[model samples]
Target: MNHDKEPAKTGTKAGARGLPVLESETLFQGRNEIVIRHQGAEYRMKITRQGKLILNK
Candidate 1:
Protein backbone atom coordinates (compact mmCIF):
# COMPACT_ATOMS: atom_id res chain seq x y z
CA MET A 1 0.00 0.00 0.00
CA ASN A 2 3.09 2.31 0.18
CA HIS A 3 3.68 3.45 -3.40
CA ASP A 4 4.43 7.15 -3.05
CA LYS A 5 7.56 7.63 -5.16
CA GLU A 6 10.23 5.86 -7.20
CA PRO A 7 13.62 4.81 -5.90
CA ALA A 8 16.61 7.18 -6.11
CA LYS A 9 19.68 6.65 -8.26
CA THR A 10 23.27 7.14 -7.06
CA GLY A 11 26.43 7.48 -9.16
CA THR A 12 29.47 9.71 -9.67
CA LYS A 13 28.89 10.07 -13.40
CA ALA A 14 25.46 11.44 -12.82
CA GLY A 15 26.84 14.76 -11.58
CA ALA A 16 28.73 17.59 -13.22
CA ARG A 17 32.00 19.26 -12.23
CA GLY A 18 31.86 23.03 -12.03
CA LEU A 19 35.30 24.35 -12.89
CA PRO A 20 36.36 27.95 -12.50
CA VAL A 21 36.38 29.55 -15.91
CA LEU A 22 37.69 33.11 -16.05
CA GLU A 23 38.92 35.74 -18.50
CA SER A 24 41.33 38.57 -17.67
CA GLU A 25 43.13 41.54 -19.21
CA THR A 26 46.42 42.98 -18.03
CA LEU A 27 46.37 46.74 -17.62
CA PHE A 28 49.78 47.87 -16.39
CA GLN A 29 53.15 46.31 -17.12
CA GLY A 30 55.38 48.59 -15.02
CA ARG A 31 53.10 47.97 -12.06
CA ASN A 32 53.80 44.25 -12.34
CA GLU A 33 50.41 42.64 -12.50
CA ILE A 34 48.77 40.15 -14.81
CA VAL A 35 45.87 37.80 -15.20
CA ILE A 36 45.84 34.67 -17.28
CA ARG A 37 43.84 31.51 -17.79
CA HIS A 38 45.79 28.26 -17.34
CA GLN A 39 44.17 25.15 -18.79
CA GLY A 40 40.79 24.78 -17.10
CA ALA A 41 41.94 26.81 -14.10
CA GLU A 42 41.67 30.58 -13.74
CA TYR A 43 43.58 33.04 -11.54
CA ARG A 44 44.28 36.72 -10.90
CA MET A 45 47.58 38.06 -9.59
CA LYS A 46 49.10 41.40 -8.78
CA ILE A 47 52.15 42.92 -7.06
CA THR A 48 50.38 42.64 -3.75
CA ARG A 49 47.58 40.16 -4.06
CA GLN A 50 49.27 37.00 -5.35
CA GLY A 51 52.99 37.69 -5.06
CA LYS A 52 56.01 39.41 -6.62
CA LEU A 53 55.51 39.78 -10.37
CA ILE A 54 57.84 38.00 -12.76
CA LEU A 55 57.95 38.53 -16.47
CA ASN A 56 57.98 35.40 -18.60
CA LYS A 57 61.02 34.79 -20.75
Candidate 2:
Protein backbone atom coordinates (compact mmCIF):
# COMPACT_ATOMS: atom_id res chain seq x y z
CA MET A 1 0.00 0.00 0.00
CA ASN A 2 1.12 3.49 -0.84
CA HIS A 3 1.31 5.90 2.10
CA ASP A 4 2.79 8.87 0.33
CA LYS A 5 1.22 12.27 0.76
CA GLU A 6 1.25 15.03 -1.83
CA PRO A 7 2.77 18.38 -1.02
CA ALA A 8 0.33 21.17 -0.27
CA LYS A 9 0.35 24.06 -2.74
CA THR A 10 0.31 27.41 -0.98
CA GLY A 11 0.54 29.55 -4.08
CA THR A 12 -2.24 31.87 -5.18
CA LYS A 13 -3.39 30.45 -8.46
CA ALA A 14 -6.31 28.75 -10.15
CA GLY A 15 -6.58 25.03 -9.79
CA ALA A 16 -8.49 22.53 -11.90
CA ARG A 17 -10.66 24.08 -14.65
CA GLY A 18 -9.50 27.57 -13.73
CA LEU A 19 -11.23 27.39 -10.36
CA PRO A 20 -9.64 28.76 -7.24
CA VAL A 21 -8.37 26.17 -4.79
CA LEU A 22 -8.29 26.73 -1.05
CA GLU A 23 -7.40 24.58 1.92
CA SER A 24 -10.37 23.76 4.14
CA GLU A 25 -8.28 23.51 7.27
CA THR A 26 -7.13 27.07 6.71
CA LEU A 27 -10.62 28.28 6.00
CA PHE A 28 -12.34 26.56 8.91
CA GLN A 29 -9.56 27.37 11.37
CA GLY A 30 -10.44 24.51 13.73
CA ARG A 31 -14.13 25.28 13.54
CA ASN A 32 -16.81 23.20 11.92
CA GLU A 33 -18.81 26.14 10.66
CA ILE A 34 -18.03 29.36 8.83
CA VAL A 35 -20.11 32.14 7.37
CA ILE A 36 -19.45 33.37 3.87
CA ARG A 37 -20.86 36.66 2.70
CA HIS A 38 -21.35 37.07 -1.01
CA GLN A 39 -23.12 39.95 -2.75
CA GLY A 40 -24.74 41.06 0.50
CA ALA A 41 -26.02 37.55 1.17
CA GLU A 42 -24.81 35.29 3.91
CA TYR A 43 -24.13 31.61 3.55
CA ARG A 44 -23.08 28.97 6.03
CA MET A 45 -20.60 26.20 5.53
CA LYS A 46 -20.47 23.37 7.99
CA ILE A 47 -18.91 19.97 8.36
CA THR A 48 -21.29 17.17 9.15
CA ARG A 49 -20.66 14.39 11.62
CA GLN A 50 -19.84 12.05 8.77
CA GLY A 51 -17.06 14.36 7.57
CA LYS A 52 -19.10 15.71 4.69
CA LEU A 53 -19.19 19.39 3.91
CA ILE A 54 -22.44 21.26 3.49
CA LEU A 55 -23.19 24.78 2.34
CA ASN A 56 -26.49 26.40 3.17
CA LYS A 57 -27.96 29.75 2.41
Candidate 3:
Protein backbone atom coordinates (compact mmCIF):
# COMPACT_ATOMS: atom_id res chain seq x y z
CA MET A 1 0.00 0.00 0.00
CA ASN A 2 1.11 3.55 -0.64
CA HIS A 3 2.09 5.47 2.46
CA ASP A 4 2.36 8.81 0.70
CA LYS A 5 -0.90 9.98 2.22
CA GLU A 6 0.97 10.59 5.46
CA PRO A 7 4.04 12.76 5.60
CA ALA A 8 7.24 10.78 5.51
CA LYS A 9 9.66 11.42 8.31
CA THR A 10 13.30 12.22 7.90
CA GLY A 11 16.22 11.58 10.22
CA THR A 12 14.62 12.02 13.59
CA LYS A 13 16.69 9.47 15.37
CA ALA A 14 19.29 10.44 17.91
CA GLY A 15 22.81 11.01 16.51
CA ALA A 16 21.41 10.95 13.01
CA ARG A 17 22.85 13.31 10.38
CA GLY A 18 19.45 14.97 9.98
CA LEU A 19 19.24 14.16 6.30
CA PRO A 20 15.98 13.20 4.70
CA VAL A 21 15.25 9.50 4.45
CA LEU A 22 12.94 8.71 1.56
CA GLU A 23 11.29 5.33 1.17
CA SER A 24 11.39 3.91 -2.33
CA GLU A 25 7.79 2.78 -2.10
CA THR A 26 6.63 6.36 -1.76
CA LEU A 27 8.93 7.68 -4.44
CA PHE A 28 8.14 5.00 -6.98
CA GLN A 29 4.53 4.78 -5.90
CA GLY A 30 4.20 1.23 -7.25
CA ARG A 31 6.24 1.91 -10.38
CA ASN A 32 9.57 0.46 -11.31
CA GLU A 33 11.20 3.61 -12.64
CA ILE A 34 11.33 7.31 -11.95
CA VAL A 35 13.05 10.31 -13.50
CA ILE A 36 14.91 12.87 -11.49
CA ARG A 37 15.95 16.24 -12.84
CA HIS A 38 18.94 17.98 -11.37
CA GLN A 39 21.09 20.81 -12.65
CA GLY A 40 19.37 20.61 -16.03
CA ALA A 41 20.31 16.96 -16.31
CA GLU A 42 17.89 14.08 -16.29
CA TYR A 43 18.56 10.88 -14.45
CA ARG A 44 16.56 7.70 -14.49
CA MET A 45 16.33 5.58 -11.36
CA LYS A 46 14.73 2.21 -11.58
CA ILE A 47 14.37 -0.91 -9.51
CA THR A 48 15.66 -3.97 -11.20
CA ARG A 49 13.68 -7.19 -11.11
CA GLN A 50 16.26 -8.42 -8.63
CA GLY A 51 15.23 -5.57 -6.36
CA LYS A 52 18.37 -3.56 -6.78
CA LEU A 53 18.47 0.10 -7.72
CA ILE A 54 19.95 1.30 -10.98
CA LEU A 55 20.53 4.92 -11.96
CA ASN A 56 21.18 6.09 -15.50
CA LYS A 57 21.82 9.41 -17.12
Candidate 4:
Protein backbone atom coordinates (compact mmCIF):
# COMPACT_ATOMS: atom_id res chain seq x y z
CA MET A 1 0.00 0.00 0.00
CA ASN A 2 1.29 3.45 -0.86
CA HIS A 3 0.31 6.29 1.40
CA ASP A 4 2.59 9.01 0.18
CA LYS A 5 0.94 12.18 -1.07
CA GLU A 6 3.90 13.85 -2.67
CA PRO A 7 4.64 12.80 -6.23
CA ALA A 8 8.04 14.47 -6.55
CA LYS A 9 9.89 11.73 -4.72
CA THR A 10 7.97 8.90 -6.32
CA GLY A 11 9.48 9.17 -9.80
CA THR A 12 6.44 11.23 -10.76
CA LYS A 13 5.73 14.93 -10.86
CA ALA A 14 2.54 16.65 -9.98
CA GLY A 15 1.03 18.43 -12.94
CA ALA A 16 -0.97 21.63 -12.98
CA ARG A 17 -4.13 19.56 -12.76
CA GLY A 18 -2.65 17.37 -10.03
CA LEU A 19 -2.15 14.48 -12.39
CA PRO A 20 0.90 12.34 -11.80
CA VAL A 21 3.65 12.39 -14.37
CA LEU A 22 5.39 9.06 -14.73
CA GLU A 23 8.91 8.95 -16.04
CA SER A 24 9.59 6.32 -18.67
CA GLU A 25 13.18 5.92 -17.52
CA THR A 26 12.00 5.12 -14.03
CA LEU A 27 9.43 2.69 -15.38
CA PHE A 28 11.90 0.93 -17.67
CA GLN A 29 14.88 1.02 -15.32
CA GLY A 30 17.64 -0.66 -17.39
CA ARG A 31 15.43 -2.58 -19.77
CA ASN A 32 14.24 -1.53 -23.19
CA GLU A 33 10.95 -3.39 -22.89
CA ILE A 34 8.33 -4.05 -20.25
CA VAL A 35 5.08 -5.97 -19.93
CA ILE A 36 1.89 -4.45 -18.59
CA ARG A 37 -1.03 -6.53 -17.47
CA HIS A 38 -4.34 -4.76 -17.28
CA GLN A 39 -7.82 -6.22 -16.88
CA GLY A 40 -6.48 -9.72 -17.66
CA ALA A 41 -4.93 -8.46 -20.88
CA GLU A 42 -1.21 -8.33 -21.60
CA TYR A 43 0.50 -5.40 -23.27
CA ARG A 44 4.05 -4.89 -24.38
CA MET A 45 5.89 -1.60 -24.36
CA LYS A 46 9.25 -1.27 -26.02
CA ILE A 47 11.81 1.37 -26.80
CA THR A 48 13.11 1.29 -30.31
CA ARG A 49 16.70 1.76 -31.37
CA GLN A 50 15.79 5.34 -32.17
CA GLY A 51 14.48 5.71 -28.63
CA LYS A 52 10.84 5.79 -29.60
CA LEU A 53 8.21 4.04 -27.52
CA ILE A 54 5.67 1.62 -29.00
CA LEU A 55 2.88 -0.22 -27.28
CA ASN A 56 1.35 -3.46 -28.57
CA LYS A 57 -1.42 -5.71 -27.37
Q: Candidate 4: RMSD over Cα atoms?
A: 5.2
Residue 40 in candidate 3, Cα distance off native in Å: 0.7
Model 2 pairs whose backbones collide: none
Please provide, for model 4 over 1-57, each residue's C-alpha lDDT reduced to its tens digit, 9 standing for 90 to 100: 135533333534586666677778767877999988899999999999999999999
Rank order (by lDDT, best first)? 3, 2, 4, 1
lDDT of 1 by residue, 1-57 (tens): 125644333334423665433322223435556555677565665665665554431
**TM-scores for the candidates:** 0.27, 0.68, 0.72, 0.69
The TM-score of candidate 1 is 0.27
Candidates by TM-score, descending order? 3, 4, 2, 1
**Ten contiguous residues minimizing lDDT sum, candidate 4:** 1-10
Clashes of each: 0, 0, 0, 0
Q: What C-alpha lDDT, on a 0 to 100 scale, does residue 1 get in candidate 1? A: 16
Please give the TM-score that candidate 3 achieves against the real structure.
Answer: 0.72
Candidate 3 residue 4 C-alpha distance from true site, Å: 13
RMSD of each: 18.5, 10.2, 4.7, 5.2
Over 1-57, each residue of candidate 2 has an lDDT whose tens digit, in order, gives 123645444546675666656788867778999998999999999999998999999
Clashing pairs in 1: none
lDDT (Cα) of model 2: 0.79
Candidate 1 residues lying further than 4 Å off, grouped into runs, are 1-28, 49-57
